[model samples]
Each structure stands twice: as structure tokens, then as C-alpha cells.
Target chain A: MSGLLSPGTKVRVRDDWPETRGPCHIRTPHYLRGAEGVVEKHLGAFPNPEDLAFARPASRLNLYHVRFVPQAIWPDAGGEALVVELYETWLEAA
Target chain B: MSEVLETPSDRLLAAVRQLLTDKGVVSREEISERIQATDAATPAQGARMVAKAWVDPAFRARMLADGAKAAEELGIPMRGMPPLGVLEDTAEEHNLVVCTLCSCYPRAVLGYPPFWFKSAAYRARAVRDPRGLLREFGTELPQAVKLRVVDSTADYRWMVLPLRPAGTEGWSEEQLAAVVREGDMIGVTFPKVS
Candidate 1:
């Protein structure tokens, strides 16, 4: 609940976990995987939907947005897209 | 030899297949079967079935409350699938799907997301700017219709049942499904006269 993950800090998506461990959606953008970004916003201590979707009542993970430049991740992003937002638990130091 | 030996997208898919094989998540037979069932012509069959619910109030009611069983009514086997939730998008609520953790999808209904839908441009912008995302999808809404973007996760896969479009007073089932494009079913597009 108390940490200094201010804006422009390096963060990585914990990709090594089992495939079925987090929230289940149709498509997750490839850019944010195992990548780094800056913390643009913080939504506070809510049950991170990534884990909460599975009804993990006990294990609560904080969520935030880690922003990434379009070109940095996508080769042909054409620099038209904005930075990405990855939850806190989904990201850590790069 | 097939002139189209393999495209870049094909290679990517094959690589994912190989990775899945190595990871023990699926067998060669499993991949083959899944591929066999997937093709452009026949896309999102079961999800379309859920779409049919809108025309029929009874079915629509059932779909909203019991998506899984409603899917089963149409013979869409969902066993062994992860926790699945069908978010029916109404005129009041506009639902959008995003996988922040991984690209986990409900293959049983909606086939595969378009390459663009799985792109960073879509994932980040959908949440950061909901109206803009809709604009990209070519479904501009009045500032009055409040948009609510729902970011999905790895715990549960989502399928959106878009609100039935107006002007479809007596359209048959097939006529209705024709306008339900993949994007429409995903809550990105509004049903249109195709």
C-alpha cells in the first residue's frame, strides 16, 4: 500500500507465471509483455482484477498504469499509439 | 509445394503452437483440432448464438443471467474452459475487453481477436481513452451515451453481447447475425446494415 513507484519508473510484466493465473480476457496487447514503462496513474488498493477474477479473496495485488511509448514495443506502431497501462502487480522493476 | 508455404502470421502461429507443445499446455492433435475448427468463413458461431438473444427477450434475459448455460443451449461446449463471463453490452452500458496479464480469450464463442485488437495501440488506448478507441473502431457515440471501458484480466475470459441495433424490426435471425461483426460482438462496433 506504501511504495514509491512514481512516474517514469521502469516496470516489467511478470510473464513467467502460469498462463491461467490472472484475469481472462480475449486479447492482451503484446507490447506490454516483459516490457518496461512509466507509472502514469495509480487507482489505489483495489482487488487487482487480474487475480480477483479468479476469486482470490485472500491474495490482493495493487494495480497501476505503466506507460510505454508505441515505437519502443511495436516495430510498426508508426508512433501513432499512446503509452500502455499495466497494473502494479502485473509490473515490477525492469 | 504450396506456393503459400507460410506467411509471417502463420509462422507466428506455428511458433506459438510449438511453444504450447513445449509448455505441455496442448498436444499436436489438440492444436490441429483447434485449427480445423477455426477459419474466417465460420467465425464466432456460439458467440453469435448469444447475440441472437437480443431479438428474443426471453433469451436475452437468460443470456444476461446465465451466459454459460445459454451457451450450452446452443451446443457450445465450454468444459475445461477457464472462468468465463459474458458481458452483455446494453444501450446504457458499453463494455470493452482487455487482457492486461496475457491474451487469454474465449475461443469457444468468439474465435480469435483481430491482430489489431491484440495490439498495444488498442490495449492502452481503450482504457486511457474510451471515446477515441470507439472512434478508431468507426462507432462514434454521442457524448450523451456514457462509455464505460472494462479492462479484463487473466482470471476470466470475456465475450461481449452488443446491444441489438435499432431499425432491425422484423429481421430474421440470419439477417441479424450478418451485421454482428467480430468487432461488434467484442463491443467495439455497433451492429450496422451490412
Candidate 2:
């Protein structure tokens, strides 16, 4: 929970949304909020887009490529895997 | 003037452009130049890379390692843009890219995202039913092949390095590139030569 995660780490996207007002911008897609997946790769730290979108002084966040099963995301979906980039703060050990 | 500005967003954009020009933040010529640059970019840039990768092993290694650098190696300017990740379509795996939140495309290499790419249906169905979506485009994938739907949700953008078509074995890079289309790199269709 406190350390950086490596590739192949099992993680779950945090379902809770951050409270904001006045045109809140977020990179974490709503459909992936509660989905669980394996960390595919750790993309280098970049400025948090949520803050950057609002013209605020932003801090860098670790971005990870998380691969999830398509069937798990959609019950009748095909066998394709869905890979998404999520901020480190939004992921937890699954 | 009111007739020209049809919508609230159009009027807003016009106002912003005027304000920026008035404040000396950006010149009108610079704006036009940027639009020209955007327009000049096309899938040919990506096709160049894909064709080169198909024939050259070393270049393919570099491209897979660093997509932006590989693009610059081929004289495509990638400055001030998000990092690009090249998804290789292997014999057993096929790659598809989508942006569910917005149309975050590799504009530097592929020009603008197509109208369908930004549509609600494409965005939703690309993730929900990618096979069905591809079939509509005349692409049929067997169950054995692993399909990967990459959501360009953050800092990185993506493009597919499609599996080279079978008939084009001895084709030159230029010949290979001619067959590489936008949809081929988008994973909705395959690059074909006849």
C-alpha cells in the first residue's frame, strides 16, 4: 500500500471518486473504477492530469498499464484483454 | 458575424483566439502554421515506420523500445506531444487502441482521429465488443488469437504495428507502406495488397 508496485502486481482500481467542483477533470475512466487487473508496466511518473487539466500546480504520479480481462469487465464480452493507464493513487493491492 | 458564429462553443473559441492574439500570446500566423502542420501529418508517417519495421530488424527493435524516438529517426516531429507506445501485432496477438474519455490520438503520426474514433459508439463498443466492432470493418479474428484493447487514458498514446500481410513477402518498404492504411494501424482492418 505504501510502496511502488512492479509489473505483474495484482491490483484493483479504487472505486471512490475524488470530490471536486467547477469542471473537474479526471484521467481514470469511470468504467474501470472498481475493476481489478495486473500491473503490466510502470510508466514513468508524470504530472497528474487531473490537476493539470484545471491549471493547478500539479505533482507527478506514477502511471501504470494495468491489464484486465475483458470478460470480467463485461459479462458477455469477448476474450480480449483491456489495458488502461491508471494513476498510482487510484490502485490498491487486489 | 453572428451568423458565422453558429454555436456557443464556436463563439467561445473565437473569443479565446481573439484574446490570445490581442495579448500577444500567439500570432494568427502561428495558429495557422500549427493547423497546417497538423493537417500535413497523416498515416503515411506511421506506415513508414510499420513498413520499415517489417523489413528491418534493428529499426524494429528501436521502434518497439522507444516509439517517439523511432518516429523522429524517420523525420517525423514528435516534440511537445505525449509519449507514443507501439503495440506489435504478433501471430498470436492483435492490438487495438481506443480512448474512452476523449479522442487522444497520435496526431503527430496519424493526423486527426477519424470521426468514428471519437463517436460514443466506437468508444463504448471498442472496449465492450471489440471483435464485433472489427467485424463491421470486415476484420475477422479467430478465437485463438488474443485481442488486446489498449485504452489511451493517460500520458501515453498508442498505434498498432500490424502483422504484415502474407502476399507481400518480397515487397520493398515503399511497396509495403503503400498498403498500410489508417485503419490497418487502428486494428479495425488489415493492410492488404492485390
Candidate 3:
């Protein structure tokens, strides 16, 4: 199909952006947005970012609910109000 | 010829960039390319959009909803970009941007991030510990302002457009934009009057 990625397609954002997940690689910050607290919880989901970063096709992908305390994310976050959702795609076991 | 703090803006940028480059502190070519992208035609269009956001809430809302299009309203396009977002640094909170791995930035709108923003020191430290990182950037919030350090990985790039400084009761957009330094937009510095 014409939609198929060209073998020669540039590898910057299209390939690299999706695959990175770890402590040392460039990564997206959506899961960490307004982040606070620590892993008080963990919900589950699918595919590995390593494969996707290089544009490897997968049948499915999983999601995650990463918990954090507001104080942890925002120092000024007070009164125990905190938590964050992180896709399984955005995390590695810490 | 050597005033202590009196290098004009352009000359200051040149002198600092040149020194940093000479010391191998920054990649000059990459930085030059980034500068070339800005102008009247660019979506950020330099000063115009920043000026608009300072005065108009609806425009700022649009900027938050669809940065690419909001930029297009000012003429910025992100066709070749990964997912991008705009983080507004309000008075109550400060936003810090980092790649935490490598440098990932929404160049189309805010231009390239500063050198230290992409460094391993900032990246690793910012994620694991944000307060420390902010301090290194010369930002020390009171016990009240919360600090949020954001990691811009491969899937998305982000930019922070900090809140306008106080004391500009009736300043024009151009004046506001003039003070909107790259660092101010990135949460590294507050807009200052000359």
C-alpha cells in the first residue's frame, strides 16, 4: 500500500521518537506531566518501545497507570494530593 | 570596548555563542541552522505569536489546544514533527524541559532549546531530582511554587511559554515579545525589562 513507510524514510521523529524508553535515551514527557509522588500503583498494558522506536510493527500495545504523590512531583504539592498516569510505553522498571 | 555588562543583544549572543563554540561547549553548525529557521515567515514568526499570547487568552487557549495550528495562526507548521505540546509556566508553578536522554525539542515554535537543556547532567538529574536541576538553572522557587521537570523523549517534544512578567500594564505586543527571551519561554529565565 502507498501508506507503507519508505525504506528510505528519514529516521528522526518517525522512527526514533516512538522507540525510546529508558533512563539514557531521549523520551517523551507526557506520562510525567504534572508528576508527583512515587509508584503507589501500577496498572498494566502492551508492546515494547524498543521495537516501536525503530518502527517495528506490533499487533498490540499496553497502557499503564503510574502513581506518584503530588509532593514528589511538585515540591509545593501539599496535603497528599498526587499521582500520575504513565503509559507502559514510557517506562522501564526503576 | 569592554563594558562589564554592556554587550548589545546581538553582539552578546555572538560573543557568547562564539566563545562557547570555541571551547567546544556547543555545536555551532546546528545552532546556526536553528537561527536560520526563524524570521517573518516562520510560524513562531519570531515576535508576533509570543506577543499575541501575552495579551489574548483565547489565542493562548488555541496555542495550548493545537500548538502546530496555533503557530500556523501565527504561521508555524509541524508537519515533520513528532507529537508536540506547549507548557505554560504560570506564576504558581515553573516548568523545566529536558530530553533526559537526548535533545528533543519543538523547534518549529520555540526554536532550539538551550545547550544545558540537552546535557546529560541536566537530563538525568532533572528526572531523578527536579529541585536540584532547577537550582542549577538559576531558578529557586519559594517554598510555595512547585517545580515540574518534564522529559521530552522520542514520541514528543515540548516547550514552555512562561507567564508574562509583571509591570507591563499596557505594553504593546512587540514590547512584550522583545522581552520574551528564549530562556523565558523555556522556563529558564523570567522576562526582564531593559
Candidate 3 residue spans exceeding 4 A from truth: A1-49, A58-86, A89-94, B1-47
For residue A88, model 2's alpha carbon misses the true position, in angstroms, by 0.4
Better of 1 and 3 by TM-score: 3
Stretches > 4 Å off in candidate 2: A19-23, B1-33
Prediction 2 global C-alpha lDDT: 0.90
Clashes of 1: 11
Q: Encode model 3's per-residue lDDT on B100-148: one tens digit a residue.
A: 5567766776665667877778666665566665566676666577666
Candidate 2 docking quality: incorrect, acceptable, medium or high: high
TM-score of 2: 0.90
Interface RMSD for each predicted structure: 7.9, 0.9, 6.9
User: For this target, which candidate reaches the highest TM-score against the unseen true structure?
Assistant: 2
lDDT of 2 by residue, B31-55 (tens): 8877777887899999999999999
Chain B TM-scores, listed for every candidate in order, come to 0.76, 0.87, 0.71
Query: Each prediction's DockQ?
Result: 0.07, 0.81, 0.12
